[model samples]
Target: MVWTLPEPMLAEPVNNPALPPGFAAEPKWDGYRALLARYADGRVVIRSRRGTDMTAAFPEITRAAASLPAGVEFAMDGELIVWEGGRVAFERLQGRLNRTAAGAAGMAAQWPAHYVAFDLLRRNGTDPDLTAQPYTARRTALEELFTDQALAPPWTLCPSTTDPTTAAEWLEWSAVGMEGLVLKNLRGTYRPATRAWRKYRVAHTADAIIGAVSRSLTDPATLLLGRYDPTGRLRYTGRSTVLPRPLATTLPARLSPAGEEHPWTGRTFSATWGAKAALTVVLVVPELVVEVRADVSRDSAGRWRHPVKPVRLRDDLAPADVPLFGDDTTTSLT
Candidate 1:
């Protein structure tokens, strides 16, 4: 019998993690969405959310899947994450996600990935088209599989609960790099490639210095933000998405350049932090500060994991008021 995996269930965006009653909430892991399967022929495959084969990219995961209890043919859906320092370390994880067999071994040993299964679609070659079944039933099946199989280490059952209170507690986890929460209707069926589930991420707000801009001081597109560390070195935190039209035009006029003492002077900036390509940018004096909406996860270098959203100009607050680190998540400024 030819074994095939079910399509991935995608999530719809929600402004907040509020779920209506009778729904279930799970931690929205900040990692790759993948499906793990074990075939009767002893073949193991780990596929990306887009259905691309990723077996060679994560040899360790394949080895774990192959070690599953013999005679167990199963397919599961979940997130593949690499945890470090008690948080989801996405930047470190990315180094392994796209690597070839030769480069993968090092990453696996350094930051081993964990497969957190959320749903069970197949067991013993049985169909039931778990997609057609309600979420509660599928969730039950997933729990049973974990219990019966005694799944260990690399194989983990994703933490889930129907209680909204418990999920609200998880929202606080964003500060330490937890991605927010995902909510699904108890009766909702898994719809492949459909946004049937809802995801509300934990957004963070903090202040950053305006180190650089997209264009010259005359007109700018986005703000390149930075923060001063304990050593007094200005490091790039992250960039904000394009500003509103008014700010993009008027703010450039207010920025002044640091003729000699500018931290970023003579320093080259990338179009993106990790990318090799450089960007043509007009560096500005780091006196002006602005508040930005950012994600909880940070790269190993202490930069925001994603481009932040510019909230407003903090003209009243001095640059010193801005926290040296962006992970200071307890502030109520928002």
Candidate 2:
């Protein structure tokens, strides 16, 4: 039976960790979502969430197909994670993401990726399409397959628990760069391209200077935040999600247009990381410090990998009170 990998199912953000009845929760690994398959004819494919072929970028993972018992074929939904300093390092994975096969091979030795499998899409290359099966059934088959094959290293079975107390404990893993918890209904089917699961991020509040805004100073739609480096340079850190109406109405009184001396006076900000679209922003005085809730996922430079949530204006705090750009003190919350 020939089978093809499908686009991965996605997760929606939830405000809290309380999962509904009959749901199972797993730690949300901070890494790229990828689908892997070992074909019945011995072909192996690794694909990104957007359907980009990533087999060449992760040779070790591709070679992991060899560990499967002869004639055993399977498809898995998982994250590709790399470790550094004894914790999952998302930046290490980014460095090798687009590398050439030879380039990736060299870097793999120092920062090899581990595939953390969360769902089994098919097994034994002969399936009634496991995606159509209930998640509990798929999960049981996945664990059994791992034990039967003695898989190791590049392959890891993601931990899942039906107990709410255990799931809540996993949220503290943010100190080691885990994003948070992903909860899936045990009876839910893996509908491709659908938000079949929900996520609860482990968040920490920190101070950031408002360097720019996406709209008028008085009614800004989004905030472009920054933190001072050791040299006192105001570095563009990350942006917040859209501001609520109340916050938008209250910010104008606190903002002032940037002067020539502003660090980002003429710098352009991308609408999103790696996006070609440029944001039309009004540079503002960087003296206004604000508190934001963000997850532990970050680049090597300590920039937030996901849009932060604006909590409130920190009128009592000064820009200097914020953590420095390279300081992990803010994100290293347990």
Candidate 3:
């Protein structure tokens, strides 16, 4: 009797120490999570992580999936990133996912999102859900099936390497903002929704002396902040978060003016940070000594992205000690 296959399992984070040496690593692309499903009848479906049907939202991609090799059904996992003006416009892809008909159409014409297919969960006459099948076998089958298709939002297979140093270099020099690296064992089989894989993320922090404090926009409280690269010649590297509440109250008087520039924008606003968005306080002083973690790679405007989280105060650190870039002092908490 023939056994049926189940939907492919997704990878989740595991203990950092579980990552053994010699595993292949690839950049974790930042974009929408999608599963491409092609039925035996040639019908295609694109489902979001929430199980929402998105085939209509990405018509061009649907057409592309239909062009895959005949007599095979496939389920592939990947992201849809729209490249515009020499940079990946994640916001444009978000607009498409939100199902704003006008907005999606405009973005599609301006910067269509590309379907980056990476893994094949199902294919040919076989059900890829069999837990015993190895990952290399599935990958090989996927490459052979989709090698000839001309899909819209074109498809690119993400490459992997066993060299951590090379992988680190790729993460640093990635033209598009890369989340990090996914390390997978070559001999491992597909383990759905399990911690069979490991991810090495690139996190950063800068040590800067406390310079000033700013009043929080939503609350009566203030935020203790600091700045790096106080020369005024270099653009703002990024702003540090407030000190702990106990320290924040007494921070104002002890703060010394590090530079002339104010760290806060003096404007109260909220913005998205990584997977979540929150209200943030902006200041323009360099008085506080603190550290911030974030991806500082250049955006479309040539400015670094702001800090996602300010870990803590670094009272022992000095302003001059901060490296402008290429310093990886922040240890991985993962």
Candidate 4:
């Protein structure tokens, strides 16, 4: 017997160009990629992104799925996210994914996963065949099926808006750790593994003080500049391409070798730029401040993307007062 499943949804990397006019935009949620399956016998299965059976991993989801109105076999697509402390803790989900039966019971009591159902692919004995239906039609069916409370932990319908300006506003004030806005054609059908949809992302940045410099493991002359947050905590952002050009000769004298080894240096060198070059070693006291831009989004580790671009030095400002954008205040999971 052939089991019905929803067409796989496609995702584009964040921080790209804008979509064409008249596209509907939705918030890119942070959670495990999930495919909800319901058999005619009222059995449900939640599959993970890697095709692992997560039905047993999330008992609450199973219980909830069983409670949904019967006489139907359906498949839904969405993310399994645990909302906590006003943020989506991806690490919490990861912990739950690897738990044993006993461990899952304990973790369930601590952190519960919320199934955010966004699309419906099959309904009852009818093959919705959503690939041929426009997004509006598919979304309407999803809203109708989830209108009742038979499903457990409740499911949130991913809201879609047509206003690009409003969508842009959402991207700007995205405290929920949104990757970006996904724009779908109102009349377009779902296409698996296709880039028919467009994604627009807002990049975030901050001005930080360069606390020190580290030598590049590849390029002897290149220097990796280290910056500090407002709280005086040091973090490596990226290397300075311009710094080596100006102070190439004087770098050796001003540099201080790091005592402890850095984890990033040992890894296979992958360059954001074209060529692979030797790393540099240099350390400076916390003195210089620079503006940096980066694509800020949560990874599987529940941490925002790091090592944004170092824009330029802030000559008029003090290193102690450089502002940090999108700190702990902005979150959507709570």
User: What lDDT would each prediction earn against the true structure?
Assistant: 0.81, 0.86, 0.58, 0.62
Q: State every prediction's TM-score relative to the real structure.
A: 0.93, 0.86, 0.69, 0.72
Please rank every candidate by lDDT, starting with the best: 2, 1, 4, 3
Model 1 misplaced stretches (Cα beyond 4 Å): 125-128, 258-261, 266-268, 272-274, 330-334
Question: For model 4, what is the error of residue 333's alpha carbon versus the real structure, in angstroms, after optimal superposition?
Answer: 23
lDDT of 4 at 233: 55
Summarize candidate 1's per-residue lDDT along 1-334 as a digit string, tens digits. Answer: 7768878888888886776799999988888889888887679988888878888878778998887767878888998888888878787667565677889988888888888899887777356457788999999988988888888888778888887788888888765567888899999988888889998877767889898888778878888888888888888888888898867767977898667677878877778746769888888888899988876768655688688888889999887777785446434321
Model 2 clash pairs? 218-252
Q: Candidate 3 overall Cα lDDT vs. reference? A: 0.58
TM-score top scorer: 1
By TM-score, the better pick of 1 and 3 is 1
Candidate 2 residue 291 C-alpha distance from true site, Å: 1.7
lDDT of 2 by residue, 1-334 (tens): 4568988999999887886789999999999899999876668899999998988889889888855656777899999998887778787876566678789998787788999999999887435479889999999989998898888988999999999888888888876788999999999999999987999887788889999999677678999999999998999889999997878988998788988998887788888876669999999889899888888888777888889989899889888888899676765233
| Model 2 CA lDDT for position 159 | 97
**What is the number of backbone collisions in each predicted candidate, taken in the order shown?**
0, 1, 17, 15
**Across residues 1-334, which tens digit of lDDT does each residue of candidate 3 receive?**
2323344455565434233575777677667778888876678888876677788788768777776666667678777776767656565665466657666667677767788876777665645552456667766766775664543347777666777667767666345566667777777877765668676555555454433334542231433333334344333333334445655555555544333355444433333323334444434344345665555343443333444455566677666555543233444342
Task: Identify the candidate with maximal lDDT.
Answer: 2
lDDT of 4: 0.62
